[model samples]
Structure formats: structure tokens, C-alpha cells
Target chain A: MITRRLPPWFVNALLVPLASVLCGFVVAGLVVAATGSDPIAAFSSLFQGAFTNQDAFAETLVSTTPYLFLGLGIALGFRAGLFNIGAEGQYYVGGLAGVFLAYSIHGVPGLIEIPLALAAGMLGGFVWSGIAGALKARFGAHEVITTIMLNYVAFLLANYLIDGGLMLAPHVSTPRTPEIDANAQLPIIIAGTRLHFGLILALVAVPLVWFLLQRTTLGFRLRSVGFNPTAARANGMSVGQTLVLSMGISGALAGLAGIVDILGVSHHMTDTVGAGYGFDAIAVALLARSNPWGVLPAALLFGALRNGASFMQLDTQVSSDLISVVQATVIIFVAAPVLVRWIFRLRRQQVAEVQITQREETAAV
Target chain B: MEFLSHQDVVGLLAQTLVTATPLTLAALGGIMCERSGVVNIALEGIMLTGAFVGYAVALATHNVWLGVLAAVVAGMLIATLHAALSVSLMVDQIVSGMVINILAVGITGVFYRNYIESSGLAGPDTLPHWNIPGLSALPVLGRIFFQNQFVTYAMLILIFAVHVVIFKTVWGLRTRACGENPAAAETAGINVYFVRYINVITSGALAGLGGAYFSLQQIGNFLPNMTGGRGFIALAAMIFGKWTPIGAFGASQLFAFSDALGSRLQIANVHIPIQFLGMLPYLVTIVVLAGAMGRAVAPAAVGKPYRRS
Candidate 1:
């Protein structure tokens, strides 16, 4: 019999992402060239801006913090077969709740106050996302539609609170809440940069999420439910409960992203706080193949692109929106691996099996 | 308090029709795609692409019709990409649609900022209102139906056309069969893939026309992400109507009426916060969706990619 060899797991893992990222750059380069800019010069500037100096590097890290948190949250949802598109709304609610608590509670010790504010943020996100989760669990409402609807509701609610003077700063004219208490503020880790303790928390969260998803019985049930809900229910797993718990945890993580943004970066909640991090985290999670451990690198790559976009714009007169193009192309390439495989002329073996299984599940439904 | 007047009511109804036109078109498009077994959440993106392309071409050619044509083509292009991914490549339909949305936004934003902004031109001319001769003279009906832009009339006609075609045509039956049970359709010797591709592409064209309405008719220019969440609302409308053309049109009218009423309330200096008024349509969508979930069953094969063994 002819022997067939499978590529090593590490090699296969790296190959797809690497090829897709390279394809993204290639497409982005074409777009840049079409716009009459030299792609090499623009990209070199991007690299220099992201990593060349201390301030730039710290800024990259600062951007990475939210992505890491949001990506982990989204990855968790994906693992549970839930699409939590409302992470943006959840982030907004979390920030609002954290700042609201920070403003209301006073004179508490720093040790007690900080965690309390953060917990409030998580509670806020949990409640917001829990609406969609509970609706999905109880009413059979699709999470995708409910989450998207909730996003608009969250925006309008935030707008109402800020503009209606409920949460507006006392002496400020802008649409923002008052600064949080000093005791609740996350300390800056790097002296001269915006880098703060939030990065440490984000880093710690990576392994924690990995452990939760890989090493725990709860994770097994969640994965089982995701793989086949009917089978999982037959096996005595409470699919509904698993969905609610996974979504709750996902919302909690996204809420932490909001709190981190407030405490470590903004120090106050603005209407635009945590602006696109929730959406960008979807890309981050996809790039990581929904693997919690892989989210760190994925988040870092996106953070660098976002951080360096301005430099690319300034140097090449190319609009920073090119990064969005790059990002979109990356997703397209990843989602349609057939295109990538065709372009690279790589042999596909186990990947086809995964696709077939996914199709079967859809068909079975 | 005499808060309402006859003229105001007439004007509001006219405004409601105008506002509902785009949504009606998009929802009908959504119905077509869903009936052919594809879940198209990318309607938002498709609409944006149409708006941007329509505006750009209209500006370049100084002809609104050409702009509309270009918008439809652009929409079809994106839809074709989505079809390739979701149908041919057998990718997850939702993820494919989401990527299409991101791609549309990125493409439109990049082109608008890099190419259009530097050109230093003003917005294109808006579409002219078309008043039917005899119908324009009717007492209440004229103001509600006759005095509107060309697109509003087209939308009404298209709604009737789609309803008739979907309910009365052999092709419609095949398309619905593909969605309800593709395997059965295949066994009956129907070309499921071809039927789906045609319906989906046509759906894109219709959504593109809706996008063109925003630029060429409604606002006369495209803004970044001008479609906002209307596409999602249209999806909600589609579901609310149980994926029927006339049903979706009715749902669209209800949403558009609420939207028009909200703006009218704001203009009337109502004491309620404007944001709360702004929240009305989305709130209604959630309530409607939640209330209709168990009762509204989607086409059985929707969101599934059919692969021949």
C-alpha cells in the first residue's frame, strides 16, 4: 500500500495563517499601488512605526490589550457555537457601568474599589449580553439577530444617558462621564508610555481562557454542545445552560475590555470609548482560528496594523483605511480556504474533512 | 391639544412611503435570497456598495440612470463573490456574508477617501419627483401615492411584481423547492445550484437598487456606512413577513412609518429624548423578532450549502 503522510500539526497550523496573511498583504499592496503609492515604502513605514521605538512599541501594547480581551471573549463564544456580535454593545455597557460605579461609590479603599469597579463593568456586560442569551435560550431567537439589534439599542441607550445629563460630566460640555476615582484607576506599568496594568491582566487572561477551554469539564460540555447539540443533549448535557454560561463568560471578558479601556487608557467613559475594538476582535478571533492561546499573537498583529496605519498614511499619503481592506481580505482568504489552497497549489487532506463535517452539521439541521 | 392636522397626516404618509422604499426593496431582495436557501446578512454591505458606486458614477457621468446601473453592477459583483464563497466553496453562510460586509465597507471607504475626496466636487443632483397626471389630482390618495420620487413608484411596482412572480411562477416554485429541501429538488432533476445562483444574483441587484435610492434619490450623495442598520432591519422585516414579498413590504411600511413618526415627533419638539425616538425602529425589530420566533419558520434548507455527493 502506498503510504500517505500528514503534515505535522504545528506546520499545518502555521501554514494557513501565514499564507492568508501574506495574501492579505498582497491584495493590500495592489490596492496601494492602484492608489499610486509604493507598497514597499508604505509597509516599511508601517513596520517602523509599530516597532522602531519605545513609545511606538508601548502604544502597540496599549492597543493589544483590548483586542486580547475581546478576542478571548469572541473565541469563547465561537467555541460554544454562538456568534456574539454584540461585544461592541457589551463593551459600551461595561464601560458605562464601570464609570457609573466609579463615580457613585466613594471613599472605599483602593484595594476594594478597583476590583469592585471592574466587577461592575463585567456585570454590566453580562446583563446586556445575557438579554440575548436568555432570549436565545428561552425563545429560540437567533443570537446573531438579537445581538445586532442589541448593539443599536446599546448605542441609543448610551446616547440617551450621556445627552440626557444622567451620566454627563458635571462641568464638562462634552458627551462624557466624569473621571473615575483615582483608587479605581489602573496604574501605568511603563513610566513614560500609556502602557498600564491592563496588559498584564490581558496576558494572564490568555492562559486562563486556554485552561478553561481545554482542561475543564465545563469546557468539554460547551465544546460538546457546539459540536452537536442534539448529541450533547442526549448525553445529558444541558445545552441551554452551557450556552448561557459560555455567553455570560464571553460577555464578562468583553466587559473587562471596556473596564481596562476606562481605567488604563481613557480614565473616563466617553461616547466613543471602546469604539471598534469589539468588531476588530472578531477578526482577531478568526485569525486565531478561535483558539484562545493563539489569540495573543493574532491580537498583536492587528494591534501593530492599527498602530502603524497612521504612519503609513503620513508617509505614503495612503489612506489608513487600507488597513481595513487588508483586514477584510484576510478574513475572506481564511473563510474560503479553497481560494488560498488554489493560489498556493497546496495539497488538502484533513481540511476537506473539516469542511465536510461543517456542511453535514448544517445539512443535518 | 390639536397636535395633528390633515395636511400633516398626508405629508407624513407620503414621507412614510418615501422612507420605506429602500427598506421594501432590500427586504424583497432578502426574501428572494432566503427563498433560494441563502442567508444574506450582507444586504447592508451590498446597499453601501450600491450607494457609493451610484453616487460616484452619477458624479462622473452627470447621469443618475447610469449611476443606478453602475450601482447594480457593483452590488452584483459583491454578491457574486459571496455566492462563490457560500455556494461553490461551501463556506459558512453567515461568516461569508460578514466578510462581504467588511469588504464592502473597506472598499467603499478606501475609494471614497482616496479617490473621491481628492477630486473636490460637490454632491450630485437628486432624483426628480414624479407626479402622475390624473392620480396627482386625487384627494387623499394623490398626496399619499402620486407625489413622490421615481424610486418610490418603482418600489411599489416591484413589490407587486415580486409578489406575483414568487407566488405564481413555475420558477418561483423551483426556487422555493431548492430552499425547502435541496436534496429533494436534486432528486427531481432540478438544477438547484443554478436556481440559487440566479435568485441570489437577482436579489443583489434589487438590494443594489435600494442602495441607489439612498444616494441618487434620497440624499443625493453617499456617506460612509449610510445604510447603517437598515439591512438588518430589512432582514427583520423579511422574517416578520415570513419571507413573502407582500408580507415583507407590509413590514417595511410599518418600520418606515415608525421611523417617519420618530423624525416628525422630533421636529414637533416633543418632550421625549430624541435618542429614545431614534431607538424606536430597532426596539420594534427586537420585539417583533422575539414575538415571532416560534411562529416564523425559515425555509428548511436556508443557511445550508448543498454539495453533490
Candidate 2:
């Protein structure tokens, strides 16, 4: 009766993630209390920093841009049943390539330069992740292990290239690449704010990904392979090819995330440009349940947390790392729906049973 | 290259074992958990928690042995969460592990910043090196094998112990049964859930000991993310070794040799860049997984939750 009363969509899309986030807050609040901090005060400051303070919301949007792109990337991978944890490495590689491309060209128009740099970035990410995909398809290698390994490799490679290497800019104290041409730099949409055009690109990417997953033939094939590779193969679909393409596309989005951060925010690629955005994006994608549209809100939540963390630290003397606790708990609750349901005292839905009975009755009729 | 003496080579080999100890421990942990049908990507997180808890306790109590104990207990506690989520609640194993990893980072970072960083407390000393009496007198072999810290000795012992236990014990057979075919294992009157829980917890204990290698044995201070992706490298070693304890040890040694070689080359002022040297272990792991050796397969029922009808 309870299952019949509430719509499945309400229970799933809204109730679950919302309840999980609430649970995450409760868990993190308990941690704050244990650490002798005022949980309520910390949370208030966090909210204020994320929303109400001057330029805070814009900064939050700036933070949200990377999460949005990376979240979409990870979500796309999850749809293909690929656990691509190499986003951090792919991000570094993408940023490196994009920055190199951006700085190499001179006198090019902004319109032409931006897309080319973006493409270079995406291509870099694709190549990095595509190696793992190829290995998996060729030798049955697990993507999880390969991607994680590649992440370290990417970091080292980035470090090598940026520090006293070819990418290091002249007359700069820091170890980083040269700044992109002014034309290549993303224009700030808001006056006197750090927020740039990448936010628009990120926003547009949501529906584009949704359309690709929902309406496109490639999306259907990818999902089918993810659902059951054996069945997909039996149905004459190239499972290997799908896996490779899915990983490449996923990596390209992560690459886009990296390049956008460089062009729009940093204006140059540094070895430390990753700053855990790729890892945080995993939490984002998991929070979204790998749904493209769901990624928007999930990314924003993470963005708000990241943007507000420093303010919370300043106000309550709580460490900014407290956000990670909240993130960890949120992911835990999101992953284990059964645990969430039990905690919330929600009944299991009978949708499958209802559908089964309807099918049987129709057959008899 | 001319500066690389025989003594230097011996020292490098000795250092290689020391570097390999933690990897071998964590890889053994991976072998244990995965052998019992639980995927534990949380080894990195558990090891980090262990290192933090170990250091914190030692700083408070001034007893390194107690610190080691605390680390193991902390790891077990974290793994208990993993078991609860993945085993009892039937959550996706990878997601649960990732949660634990992230949680460890947050918890450790917060505690380190608030208590340790602000207090400016001096950390307890590193674990005492044990020089074996007669064996340490032997020229090259003795120093390489005998002169080491407590964790290194324990790691060598554990490598053999895990091999014997996993291959020779009845419990190990039951654990393998659960991993290979949990439904059949359940039908055979083996408690699949119980086996999984115990193995996963045991794996946590192993990874916890590995965590002590950093804080108690080597560094004498806990740093955030100091485990430095060793947990993932251990996972690769587990897969590369095909989930065997000895094989994991061998793979760990190979990775460790590369790490040690990099440092040795740096000391000798080799032309190779430092970044490339730092990258050796990760690159080797990728190469190993690409099947340059051979195909490595996992247990059939591993990473799947069992349901009884």
C-alpha cells in the first residue's frame, strides 16, 4: 500500500538522494560535535559562503563548472558499466594538451582558438583513457586498476612537463605553463567576477548528454552492452567497440573539464591543476545515480560544499576537510539504498510484482 | 654510474625490501578480501586511517606498540563499515570502498589539521631497527635480510603465513568457495556471509599493519595522503599476482625495486628526470595489467553479493 501510494519516480529521483544528503549532513554534524565545534554555526557559515555572501555564488558557480563537466564524464562511463577512475590523470593530460594548443597559436580569433583548444583537450583525455579501454577490450584487463595506475602516471607526466620542462613559462617564479592567448581565454560573462563562459558550456552539456543517452542509437547500444555484454554480443553488437567508444567519450568530457578549468579559471596549466576535482566528480556521479540530468543538481551540491568549505573553516575553526566526510557519507548512503530505506523506514516498491501480474493476466486473456 | 658500488647495490636491495613491505601487506589484504568474494578498494583508505590512528595514539600514549595495535583496530573498524554496506546491505562493493577511502581522507585531514598541526606536537620516534645477532655479521646477505624495522620483519613473516593459511587451511577453502561460487557454497552448508565478513576484516588488519609501516616504521610522522596510492598499487599487485600471497609478494618486490632504483639513480645523479623516476611504479603497474606477462583472472563470484532464496 505504501509503495502504491508514492510514485516510483518520487521515491527514487527525489526522496533517495535528498534523504542521503540529509543523512550525510547528520553524520558530518556528529563529526563536528565530536571535534568540539558548533555544527549549526559551521553549517550556517557554509550556507552563507555558498549563497548569500558577495561574489560567493559566482565563486560557487566557478567551482561548479569543473564538477559539472567531470560529473557528466563519470556518469557517461557508469552508463557503459566502465569504472574510469583515471579522470584525474585524463584531466591533467587534457589541461596540458589544451594549454599547449592554446599557447601555440597566435593571432587566431577567439571563436576558432577556443574550439581548437577544447578539441585538443578532449583528444588528450580520450587517448589517456582509451588506452585503458583498449587493454580491457583486448586482454580482459580491469579498467579500475588501469585507470588508477594511469592517474599517478598522469600526475608525474604533468609534473615533468611543467617543472623546468618545455611547458614552463619564462620569467615566472612558479612551475607552470605559459598563459593562453587573450583570444583563447574564456571571457567572463559577469562583470568583475571570476565566472566565465565555461559555465554556459557546462549547462549546455547536460541536455546534450541526456539527448545522446536517451535518443541516440549509440547511446542505446552503449546501454545495452552495459546492461548485459553477452546479450549485446549475441545481438550482433560489437561489445569491444562500444566499450572503447564509451570510454573515449567519457574521457573526452573529463578532458573538457580540465581544459575549461585552465582556460576559464587558471588561464594556465600547473602540475597541481587537478586538485582532486576528478575524484570529487566520482562522488558527484554516484550522487546523481549516473543519470545525466541528475548530474546538474549533484554537481551544484558538490560545488557549493567546496566553495563554502573555506568559509566554514574560517567561521567555526573546523577544518575544510570536513566536507570530505560529508561527501563520503553522502556517497555511502547513495550507494546503499537499502540502508537508506531502512533508516527512513520506507517500504520496498512492488513495481516488478505488479508488472509481472499484469503480463500474466494479459497472457491468460 | 661509476659511483654505484657493490655496497650501494646491496643497500638498494635492502631498501627495496623495506619499500616493498607495505605493498606486500596491502596486496595480501587485497588477496584475502577478494578471495572471500568482497572487493576491497578501501585498502588505501584503511591504511591511511591506520597510519593516522596509529600516529595519534602513539602521540598521546608514547607507546609505539600500542600505536600499532590502534592502527589495526582502526582499520578493522573501517572495514566493518565496508562489510556492513557491501555484505549485509548488498551495496555495490566498489562504491562502498570508495566511500571509505574518501571518509578516511576527510577524517584524517580534519584531525591532523585541528589537533596535530595546531598543537605542534612532536611525533614519537620511528620503530627500532632489529639487527639479527649472528646473521647480521654475514657480509652482504645479512644486512640486506636482517637489519630492518619491526614492520619489515613482520611483512616477510606475513607473506609466508598468508601463503600457508590461504592454501593449506580449511577456512581458506571455505573462503575460496564463497568467492568462486557463493550459492553453491551456501548449499554446501558453508556460511558465505560469515566467511566474507571474517576475510574482509582480516584483510583490514593486514592493511592496517601496512599503515604502521609509514607512520611508526619509516616516517615517524603522519602526513595526509601519505599512503600515496599504494593501496591501488597493491590492488594491481593482487591482480597481477593472480590473488596469490607469494605472487603478490613477488609483484610487490618488482614494483618496489623500481621505486628503489629510482632513488638510487637520483643519488647517483643519473640524467633521468625525477618525475620519471617517481612514475616508475605506476607505469610498471599499468604495463603489468596490460598482460605483458599473461592474463590474470579474478574469482568468479568475487564482487557479487549473495542472496539466498
Candidate 3:
């Protein structure tokens, strides 16, 4: 079934994603109409809201900052054939660690404090991901169940701390942490918009990840292990160690995503901080086919769609929740590339679509 | 204190059994699907689909059995959809299950909202409780077993039947073969895909029956996400039970007891961070799963697509 005929230049690699986006907008339009609203008018407003003003474009990029980091983190792990579903939990732990380090070590210089907090967050994410890796390597515990269960643990644990132990604002009628010191805050890249140095930091990380993956011995081992652990082990590589390290690196990247939100953007920590970035990152990474460099564009697209959704709702009278439906549909198409191929009558894929699931991918275990 | 007296203990156990009925049945369904080598992660989705269909039919026809029938049929239908996507198309099974789960959540949430907020339909007729004739009057054990709805008894019977069918029959052997090693079984002249297909759909029907218990037996109204990770918990139990039907049944009871205990503790006003206490079952499930680490191996061909390579 491996079709030797390559797809036409236009309907090939780039077109699928473009077509998926068109499919998304069409669905978005219908949803707007179904709500008794004008689709074209709503979309125009959404477009204007997202891009017309400098501030709006900045805001879209601001939101894109975290998605880019987290997407790349998961993307790296995905290339190694590891699914780090615990990215959300890792992000939570990382955010808390970054905020905690910033608040406690106030006297440090700006350069030192900011880097320290990021390191703390990355360390938090690294440790969290390490748990999954150790389980996979030593115990053969499935990451899926462990990851989901750990999410509840991380969330509840973080909730308890914010709600009681580290109550920075107990009288504020909400569970949230105090703001980090001014020295720890990431500077604004734009004069007025919410966009900060985090976007630059995220951009820097993309190329750094690509380089480390493409030109390093460690990256080769990780990819080898991902492609086939048995073969890698036979080739004298430490498969288990590579898995743990890959997981840790994945978590570290995810952790950086959390730090970007708290120190670089929000300037404070709260319960809603992660805000589904972990899950959204999955879509971003998947859309990029786990390519580190590709994640930026995928993330920006998601960022734009999400950024425009509110205006889409307000102006077109579309149910904003349809964004959720559209998002899930994109996930369906990406995860099942066969559907995308079937829809376009694609010549058979050159390579099989990568099976990204960990284990017991079926319902049983 | 009064809730735990020896005499009152029997009553609590009786209530526990009734409460555990659906979870138990659902776990059994979960066990069958897993044993047959299909990751039945869509237990929640299938259960939701069953719940929706059962409620819709019961409301339309006003017949309790018809509602149950519709649920079973609908469950099989959804199962077939899942099977085709996962088993046939060779998509990632986890994503396939997740697709069903998300679709179920979105569809049921939208439809349930429409039904309640806009449809203006009156409530469907619910089943009446049935009591065993002479057995209902005896002491503790008698009351425990005899005083319950028809689904409760049917649940127990069905589980036992699954036990018999799985352990005592040839079909069960073939089904197990598919899960444990499909390629070898196919070489052995067993129709691996056919066996898996039947088992998966049967399990879906079972999940559907478990769902009917929610709408028709437990409550007349359908609430969104009412399955509430019970499907995942059942998955945990299925593995914790070593992929055996009876083992899964016991595991479900253990989880049900945890749920019952959590409720009782909340009512008792135990000041212990109910959060940590509330975290008990999930935490225990985590520990139990970890303990089973490197121990409970999945079917060798659990997620591999058969392409005659």
C-alpha cells in the first residue's frame, strides 16, 4: 500500500495543513451562522480584532509565547516516540517553583533572579517528567494512567498550597500567590502591548532545540531510542537512560512555558495559570508532526484562532465554545492522518503516520 | 458511630451492593473488552452513548425494557464505530478512545442541554423497584440480597455469566487468544479480527447496559459527565484484576467502597483535609497501579494494527 507516486507539488506536505485550516474556518463560519449571526461580518471583525491594531497583534503574539515553548517541549519528546501527557502537571509544578523562587530570593540582581527562577521552573518540570520516565524504564508502568493520575495530584497539591500553605492573599477571596519582585519580571518587548521578552525567549528556544537535536550526539541517541528501543539497546545505547533524559528535557521545556506565563507575563501566580496550555501544546506539537522548528507556526495559528475567538463570538454571535469543537476536530484530523488523506484522496503516504500513543493505546490497560 | 453498628453494618453493605451494581457491571464489560485485546477506553463514551439512547427511547416509548434494549443496541452501534476507527483504520487507539470520549462529552452536553432547556419534554417513566418474595423478609444477608431493583440482580447474574462464558467456553478461549496474541491465534485458525470484533461490541453492549442502570434504574434524568472518570477507574480495575472478569468485579467493589467511604467521611465532618481523604481512591489507585508495575503486562498485540506484514 506504500504508494510510489508522490502527491502533486501543491497538494503535498504544505497543502494538508492549509486545507485543515480552511476546514476549520468553514466550520467556524457555519457555527457562527447557526447562532443566527453573520459569518463574514463576524470573521472580518475577528480579523480586525486580532490584527488591526498594533496592540491586538502584540496580544496575539503574547499568548502565542507560551504555546510555542510548550509545543516545542512536547514536540521533542514526540519525535523520540515518547508522549509526555504530564506536560500540564509539569507546567503547574514549574510555574509554582518559578514563582516561589522569585518571591523568596528578592535581593538578587535582575539578571540573576530571572534566570534563577527559570532554572527553578525547569528543574521542577524536569523532576516531574523524570517520574514518568523512571516508571517507564524501571517499572514498565504505563505513562498514560500515571500521567493522568499525576495531573490530579499536581493540581490538588498546588491547590492546597495556594489555598492554605502559601496563601499570599488569604483575605482576597481567592487562592493565588504574590507577585514576584520587579527584578524577576520579564521586560516588555513592545512599548504598550502585553508582549514581553518571553516571545523572544521562546523564539530563541526553538532554534536552540533544533540545533541540539540536529547536531548533537545526545539527540541522536534520543531519536534512536525513540525509533526503536530494542535496536538502540542492541547498538550499545542506554535506552532507559535516554528515555528518562528525554522525558526530563520534555518536562523542562514545558516548565519553561510555565515560567514564561508567571514571571515574564503575569508577574504573579494563580490557580488558573496553566489555562490548558499543556493540552493546547499537544495539538500544536501534533500539527507540527513533532518538528521543533515547525511548532512555532502551528502554535501561532492556534494563538490567532484563540485570540480571534472572543471577537468571533461577540461580533458574529457565534458560540465561542465552537472554538473548542473546531479545535477538537483539528486534533481528530491530525491524530488520524488517514482521515485527512481519505478526505483529499491523497496518494498513499510516503511513511506511515507515526503512532504517538505510549502503551495500552487500546482501551484495556 | 450509629452507621457502623453490627446490625446497621448489614444495611450499609446492602446499600453498598446496590450502589456497586452499575460500577461492577461496567467493570465486567471493561474486563471483557480488555481481555479480548481492544483497549476499551471508550467505556465512558460508550456508556454515555448508551445513557443518551436509553433515555431518548424510554422517553419516546414509555417502556423500561425498551429503553434497556435501545441502550444495548446503541452501545453495540457505538462500539462498532470505535472498532472500525481503531481496529480497522489503524488510528492510534488512545486517540480513538479519546475522540469518542470528547465527542460523547460534547454531544451529550449539547443534547442534554437542549433536552432540558429547550425540548420541553416531560420526564421519562422510571423503573419500579422489585423485591424478592419470601427472601426479602429474612435477616441481614437476606435483606441485603433480596431488596433491590431488577437491574441489581441482573448485574450480578450478568457478571457471573461473563465469568462462566469467559472461563468455561471455547469462545472465551478464542477471545483471550486475540488479546494475548492475535497473530499466533490467527495462525492457529482462529479468526482473530472476528473474535475481537464480537468481543468488543459485546463489551460495548455490556457498557450500555451498565449505562441503562444509570438512566433507567438509578435516576430518571441524565446528567453530563455522570460517568465521571468511572470509566477510567474501571480501566484501572481491569488491569488491577490482571485482566480477569472476577478480578475486575472485586476491583470495582473496592473502588465503589472507596467512593461510599468518601461520601460517609464528608458527612461525618471529619476535619482531616477531605481533600487528601478525597484523594484517597485516586491515590490508592495510583499506588496500586505502581505496585502492579512491571507485573501486569498487557496483551502483546494490544495496540498493533494487523496488516499481514
Task: Predict model 1's lDDT versus the native.
Answer: 0.82
- Which residue pairs in model 3 clash with each other? A362-B39, A363-B39, A363-B40, A363-B41, A364-B39, A364-B40
Q: What is the lDDT of residue B26 in candidate 3?
A: 69
**Cα-based RMSD of the predictions, in order?**
2.6, 4.7, 4.1
Say what the interface RMSD of candidate 1 is.
3.5
What is the CAPRI rating of model 3's predicted complex?
A: acceptable
lDDT of 2 at A74: 89
Question: Residues A267-295, candidate 3, lDDT per residue (tens digit)?
Answer: 87777533767866777887777878778
TM-score of chain B of each: 0.95, 0.96, 0.92
Badly placed stretches (over 4 Å) of model 1 are A1-8, A350-365, B1-3, B291-294
Instruction: State the lDDT at B122 in candidate 2.
Output: 87
Across B60-88, the per-residue lDDT of candidate 2 in tens digits comes to 99999999999999989999999998888
lDDT of residue A89 for candidate 1: 92
Candidate 1 A-chain TM-score: 0.93
Report the alpha-carbon TM-score of model 3 versus the true structure.
Answer: 0.86
Residue A202 CA displacement from its true place in model 1, Å: 0.8
In TM-score terms, candidate 2 sits at: 0.96
Q: Determine which window of 10 residues in candidate 3 chain B has minimal summed lDDT.
A: B109-118
Better of 2 and 3 by lDDT: 2
